[model samples]
Target: MNGTLYVGVTSDLVRRVAEHREGVVEGFTKDHELKRLVYFEAHDEIGAAIQREKSLKRWSRAWKVELIQKFNPFWDDLFDQICG
Candidate 1:
């Protein structure tokens, strides 16, 4: 579970995730297969999501993992569920 994690904000998570999975967009996520959508949040405003993303990016790995585990204790790949 020490895999790479890429944090960012996207209004259209579905399309954005598709790009990451296909490697259409090159970056840390693509290089490390960090395409698993293990955690996500819905905000009424993009600004809120952006702020939250920044906050998450600054969190320690343990803190981030705990946050994810709160909802997905097994760290399941939620890509299909969210993207579907």
Candidate 2:
């Protein structure tokens, strides 16, 4: 939790988060070491998910943090919650 923020769309949340946690993918998340999954949402359709991802990317940092805090008050890692 280095306070770095990255946003993207993923079809498989568990696999994608695992990749980030393991540093399996060489990119922004790995470079920033953004392992904690503080926030996420599921969309019924890929199109909608993509659109939402785009929207979230454009949001201000303050807005994004606020959203995350609302969803996760303590900013807890939700990886295990999803895995179990």
Model 1, span 1-84: residue lDDT tens: 687767889989888888887888877777887667888889999889999999999999989888889989898878889855
Q: 20 in model 1: Cα distance from truth in Å?
A: 0.9
The clash number for model 2 is 0
Please give the CA lDDT of all the candidate structures: 0.85, 0.92
Best by TM-score: 2
Candidate 1 Cα misplacement greater than 4 A, ranges = none
Query: lDDT, candidate 2, residue 5?
Result: 85
Candidate number with greatest lDDT: 2
lDDT per residue, candidate 2, 1-84, as tens digits?
238888988999999999999999999999988888989999999999999999999999999999998899898999999999
Q: After superposition, how far is residue 63 of candidate 2 from its true place, in Å?
A: 0.3
- Which segments of model 2 are wrong by more than 4 Å? none
Q: Alpha-carbon error at 48 in model 1, in Å?
A: 0.5
In angstroms, how far off is 10's CA in candidate 1?
0.3
